[model samples]
Target: MSESNSAGMFSGRKSEGLVLVVDDEPDVRKVVRMTLEKSGYTVLEAEDGEKAIAEMKKDENSLLLSLIITDIRMPNMNGIDVINYYRKEWPSVPLIVLTGFPDMDMATSMLQHGIADYLVKPVEAEKLRSSVSKTLEKREVHGF
Candidate 1:
């Protein structure tokens, strides 16, 4: 990415930035999208890691992404792969891991990778909102 394009995402001009939600379940995606949209954030959906990467590559708005929330148990392309891709290509965009099967090792590893949050499945709406808010705030202050 170009320096100007990278700067755009962290420009801090917008009140809320676009977020990418990656999960195989449509219902989960819908809930996340609705929750985020209601909180004044624009959101995009992807079924898996591969699709998420494709969307980022193809969509113009993806360049404005401020956050990514991904589920770990997705088929074909899991959250680990998604995290790896993000850390490699867009490490400035903060990530959150939402998983049903939470493992200590995995959470530790993901946290070490600098992910913003690791939330368990069936997360409360308020909790999700709070996490997103806090993560975004941290990004603004820390730029990471």
Candidate 2:
């Protein structure tokens, strides 16, 4: 994404909220970051839940996060733990889960745990953008 395009995405907005994207795959993270950055959000990436948690903690003073997008499976720590931690510590921030497994039980569990949306792996660009837009819109409307 061009700097001009990214800047234009939030030029008239009051705030261009930061988004955290977590996944073990570098390719996935790159695509996600590009997608979100093109849409005007500042994106942070972490390779695993531990790194994600550290990123969150490091930004505690800033607290500019508007959303989190994470993959379900990872080494060291999984997305479930990350989601649970954020749900408790930063309940106001919305979360979206991206997983390859797509098990019914896991989906149900994620929803029950306060995820704003769930997406399957190999996500299309349009789908990712749509999901993100809708989720962020909901957060804005509800004053989350």
Q: Which has the greatest TM-score?
A: 1
Pairing residues by index, what is the TM-score of model 2? Answer: 0.79
| lDDT of candidate model 2 versus the reference | 0.76
The clash numbers for all candidates, in the given order, read 0, 0
Clashing residue pairs in candidate 2 are none
Off by over 4 Å in 2: 1-15, 59-62, 76-79
lDDT at position 41, candidate 2: 73
Error of 1 at 141 (Å): 0.7
Per-residue lDDT of model 1, residues 1-144, tens digit only: 111222234343343777888888988888988887677776778888778877788636566778989887755545577678777877788999988966888898889877899998889999999999999999889865
Each candidate: what lDDT? 0.78, 0.76
